[model samples]
Target: MKKIALCAAALIAAIPAASFAQEADSTEATAPDGTRAFGIEPYIGIMGGYDSYDKRSEFGSPRGGKMNGALIQGVAGVNVPIGPAFVGVEGNVAKGFGDIDWEYGVKGRVGARAGESGMIYASGGYEWVNGKRAYSDQKDWIYGVGVEVGPKDIGLGGVTGNSGVRLRFEVDTYDFDSIRPMAGAVVHF
Candidate 1:
């Protein structure tokens, strides 16, 4: 009887070890080569924070105010793999409101993914806004770096599909002294 009990314990331990090995094998099999063959991911997000405006002698005095607002964006782009690197572009539209004022703009970003699920990346592009129009212009450049966390098959072809949340921190120099942090989610199809 004692021998049988010992055998049962040994079997249970072996079962867990086998299961772990299977999981590791599957992860390696599905490992992304940093490329997305084809996919359509549309995301909508909101950003809120503060903006510090450098006093332009020609414009007036230095003014800093609370910057909090919402943005609705649609992204249409492709994920490509260059060796172990992942590159992609996204077209976006943003509408914002805050103490500084209200404005909207269209922008695009080009970035690479490193570490599983692009745990980190740097993206930069241009933005055109129409509203109170700070700096006596209609638009400007928007660029920043951010970190993302998700699954390795996020944009890869798979049966389970890609669905996860993303958070980004960005600083735009278009307005002389405007820094913003944005957080949002993405649904890949």
Candidate 2:
């Protein structure tokens, strides 16, 4: 029975790997059609945002009202390009003011390239929110959608050709319990 279970698990794993695999290509920086050659792109950025907790949120204030705060965060991630689409993993740490103490999370992103060097993506992740001692700490699943616009997309192609810098804006929900809006810039390499 153990051997049978092991074989079944192996098959389940191999099936997805087999479907995504493709014929190998030469190790060149850019493909013939002018897209990125098969490689990983790593990025880092800083953002500032606001979080508004639902009135019914577990992290309520001592006065029995909703809690809200401003936050600053640093993020890092790596993306694997697959043709015009890509998949990535990202992590972030944030410091909060007002009723919040700290927030941190890790998420997975998937999206497609848009308009020269821009991207539109969706992300889902797990987050931990720490509140001031007067409030409670909570952890939940978060979901977001965001866009990144590169120099070329924003009409700076002549001066900053492929500079690997982008402007990002996103909105996220904290377990359908809070609203978060953030904007920032990211540099990729």
Every candidate's lDDT: 0.45, 0.81
> Tens digit of lDDT per residue, candidate 2, span 72-184?
99999998876556678999999999888999999888776778888887787889999886778889888888999988888998888777889999998898789999999
* lDDT of each residue in 40-147, candidate 1, tens digit only: 334444444444433442223246322333444444444443333334565655554533343444444334345555535444456554334343334555555566
Tell how far residue 121 is off in model 1, in angstroms: 2.3
Query: Which residue segments of model 1 deviate by more than 4 Å?
Result: 1-52, 57-77, 99-110, 133-137, 151-165
List the lowest-lDDT window of 10 residues for candidate 2: 23-32
RMSD after CA superposition, every candidate: 16.6, 6.7
| TM per prediction | 0.52, 0.81
Best by TM-score: 2
Clashing pairs in 2: none
